[model samples]
Target: MWEALVQPFAEFGFMRRALLGCIAISVGATPVGVFLLLRRMSLTGDAMAHAILPGAAVGYLVAGLSLGAMTIGGLLAGIAVALLSGFVTRVTALREDASLAAFYLISLALGVLIVSTRGSNVDLMHVLFGTVLALNNSALILLCSIASITLLALALLFRPLVLECADPQFLRAVSRLSAVTHFTFLALVVLNLVGGFHALGTLMVVGIMIVPAAAARFWAISIGGLILAAVTIAVAASVCGLLVSYHFGLPSGPAIILAAGLAYGLSLTFGPTGSFAARVHPYRHADA
Candidate 1:
């Protein structure tokens, strides 16, 4: 069993790359995502995820699955979602949630249509479910580069962006820096999501960005603490998921998601903040 477990790592280059790629992505995505939840922007991650399809379709027709082409397309599609949703609300009376909902549905449909016209469902499934364990060396390099740039961008923006999310009005009035912070964070999200999609696929990568953060919230009551917890969960899940699937012959991407889900469940059930166990503390209630 041990040899079978370690054998894939040694023999398969793709498996090695997949392991490293998932860890890096999880590290970058967890922090950003935790705050997205804090900001009530989880749905935006969902929208950006599905929007990858149309972008990927265009890229496929033009340059096949080349990472440059796909990343460009995914980046554009993600920004377009942000801008369109922002535009609708700025111009009309609709709530941001409603505008984002409309944008996500439309982008999802358009992506499907484009894919149907030009590509196979098999390719779509590969993109949606991921080709992580099957990645070429070029895809690995591209994924690593995208992850690094995104992490670097987030490191620069972390303080201002967190401030803006938690206290947007204060930042805008006092620092005169809200616009810079907001747009820079959005751009980093674009980079992160695009990079994550390469491994986790379009729709499912949202799990990478959102689940660990959701779980981390159970243990974290502050921005910095939450981010630390989320990154911890993300990396643990990534490593465990890859090993579980590699040894057991399960698909790699979904395994990572399942591991994340387990973390989320444990946190919700037992962590300190709003945990079920925390809420129903029998000993405390007995004293009362």
Candidate 2:
């Protein structure tokens, strides 16, 4: 059993690369996800993930499997969507969510059309679902670099970001940094998503970012603890999903996401924060 468990990573370089990429993504992206959750912008994050597709599709059409091309395309697309959504929200009466939903849907349809016009369904699958186990050295380097940059940026912006999340109006009232903070956070999200798309694709990258963060919320009370819990959950899920994919020939991206979903489910029921059991049996815990 131990041999069966250990042999895959020990024998296959691709599996090792996949593991490292996913772990790097988790470490870098999950904290941003926690902030998204706190800001109640989970849906916005999902929308931005889809918005990345059209740009990536265009990149693929032009450069044909070039990571740099695809990464730049995704970043541009995601930023455009984010900026457009903010603009719409400011200019019109529609809320940010509605604006994002409309734009992202259009983005997704455009991506599909572009991909269909230029590529096969297999190529489309690759763009949407990614090829984690096939990460090259360059991809690994990109993931690790994004992780380092994200952690550093988060560390620098922690206070302002926390204030922005907790009370945006007050943050704005106190300083001009609010808008800068917001945009920087969005850029970080785009960077992480672009990095993630290399491993998990446009569709599934959001899951890697959001699911672990959601699961961790039920287990952590302080902001520091929350970030730690989210990262831990994400990394653990990545390992488990990789193992499942190796052993059973499942899709690595969705397998990793499913592992995170399972953790979310378990946390919802049993975690320390506001879990089902705690809610249902408050008196029992109080006595204990």
The clash numbers for all candidates, in the given order, read 0, 0
lDDT of each: 0.81, 0.93
Model 2: lDDT to the true structure: 0.93
Worst 10 residues of 2 by lDDT: 277-286
TM-score of each: 0.91, 0.97
lDDT of 2 by residue, 195-286 (tens): 99989998899999999999998999999999999999999999999999988999999999999999999999999779997788867756
**lDDT digits (tens) for residues 180-278 of candidate 1:** 887777776777888888888887788989999999989989888998899889888887788888778898888998998999999999997878998
Candidate 2 ranges beyond 4 A from true positions: 283-288
